[model samples]
Target: MLYRVSVSFHKNYLTIKNDSIEIGIMEKPVKGKANAVIVKQIAKHLGVSKSKVRIIAGEKSQDKIIEVMS
Candidate 1:
């Protein structure tokens, strides 16, 4: 399924809020500069594989699209 996420990127953290669903989490992106680190951290929290989470769109922008497998 596809999940639409509204993201807020901070200097050291990222908060994603989904209004349509009931999910809540404010996460730190990473200490370093790799985008992969943020992705991995979120995937781990969601109990999904790293490969299953992707910034399908808006990699550079705040709002993003994420696909989670069944």
Candidate 2:
């Protein structure tokens, strides 16, 4: 599955809305810390391994494209 994810820093939560996902991450975007948490959170939510979820685009921006392999 592919998703367009919008990231925000408020709380730790992930919400799936249609083809988009709204993510509220607690970790700061430092040295990929927030990205790591995003991957982990998505993987956990989908009941998949961390390796299965990947950020295909926008690694340095608030909006990201994510690809998930089953």
Candidate 3:
């Protein structure tokens, strides 16, 4: 099971590692790769499980609509 998430990614990663990927955004758009970090942060703040958040759409756009499910 999975869920869709929408967010903007900015460079928050201090160092590149295989196991750890960092992403962050300020209330606005930032230039960076849209990865799991952003999704995780949003999900956590939303009080939802990480597994419930996934990037189902809008790979290169700002306005993204995510589907929430059980």
Candidate 4:
């Protein structure tokens, strides 16, 4: 399954509305920390492994295309 997610960083809390996912993380965007958290959270939310979720595009942008392998 593939999902399109619109992400917002530095929010007060993490939320998922429709195809959008807002995450609140203290980690900076440097060194791919924030992206890591996004993948982990998405995997947990979808009941999948972290390895199963991959960001196919928009790696440095808020709008991302994710591929989820079942």
User: How many clashing residue pairs appear in each of the predictions shown?
Assistant: 0, 0, 0, 0
Candidate 2 per-residue lDDT, tens place, 21-59, comes to 999999999999999999999999999999999999999
Give the per-residue lDDT of model 4 (tens digit) for 3-66. 7777766663566766666566656788788789888888898899999999999889878888
lDDT of 1 by residue, 1-70 (tens): 6666555544344444562212233444444334465567667767889888776775654455667664
- Candidate 3 lDDT at 49 equals 83
TM for every model, in the order presented, reads: 0.56, 0.96, 0.45, 0.79
Which candidate do you rate higher for TM-score, 3 or 4?
Answer: 4
lDDT of every predicted structure (CA atoms) = 0.55, 0.96, 0.48, 0.79
Ranking by TM-score: 2, 4, 1, 3
Candidate 3: the clashing residue pairs are none
Least lDDT summed over 10 consecutive residues: which range in candidate 3? 13-22
Which candidate number maximizes TM-score? 2
lDDT leader: 2
- Alpha-carbon RMSD to native, per candidate: 5.2, 0.7, 10.4, 2.0
Better of 1 and 4 by TM-score: 4
Evaluate model 3: give its lDDT.
Answer: 0.48
Ranking by lDDT: 2, 4, 1, 3
